[model samples]
Target: NQIHSPFWCPTTIETPTKKSEFPVPPCSTPFNHVNSSALSYEAQEVRRCLRQGLIESPEMSHAESLVLAELEDKLRAAVGTRYPQDD
Candidate 1:
């Protein structure tokens, strides 16, 4: 018997922007390093939906709201504590 794990690497290694980069702190979520204002409009809407309790399905919970909140916190920490709504 033989066992194998799948691993991959890209031929091109593009530099990371806060929007598209690997995290400086790996455990953090995506958008954790992006500016709320700098984020794409779609990102902003998703954040809004997450915070507004518009989740459509029972599979999603308020706990997800907490995760979204924490992600926003980490993003704020990275980008100097801004909230898009405050703009």
Candidate 2:
């Protein structure tokens, strides 16, 4: 019995037939060291959905919401480490 995340919808996975719809952000500093082409298929899918606003939409599934929360926590932690707060 294999378990899968609720966010995994086979119907939603499709090859892009046209030009890449995922737009690169204007500020690329955060992604400078990361290679987009080296990302795994699953990561690419998540990136595509994130760029499309599907991940943050009102209709987002519970699994997506959880994933988003985790991503946010990771981002906060990374930022904190990069620029420590003075208190």
* Top-scoring candidate (TM-score): 1
lDDT of 1 by residue, 1-87 (tens): 212221121122344432233222233335543333333444666777778887643445678878988887887779897768757
Per residue, candidate 2 scores C-alpha lDDT tens digits across 1-87 of: 222222232213234453223322344445434334333555666777788878444455778879997787788687874434423
Model 1 residue 37 lDDT score: 31
- RMSD of candidate 2 to true structure, Å: 12.6
Error of 2 at 38 (Å): 34
Lowest-lDDT window of 10 residues in candidate 1?
A: 2-11
What's the lDDT for all of these models? 0.50, 0.50
Q: TM-score of every model?
A: 0.28, 0.27
Off-target runs (Cα >4 Å) in candidate 1 are 1-59, 82-87
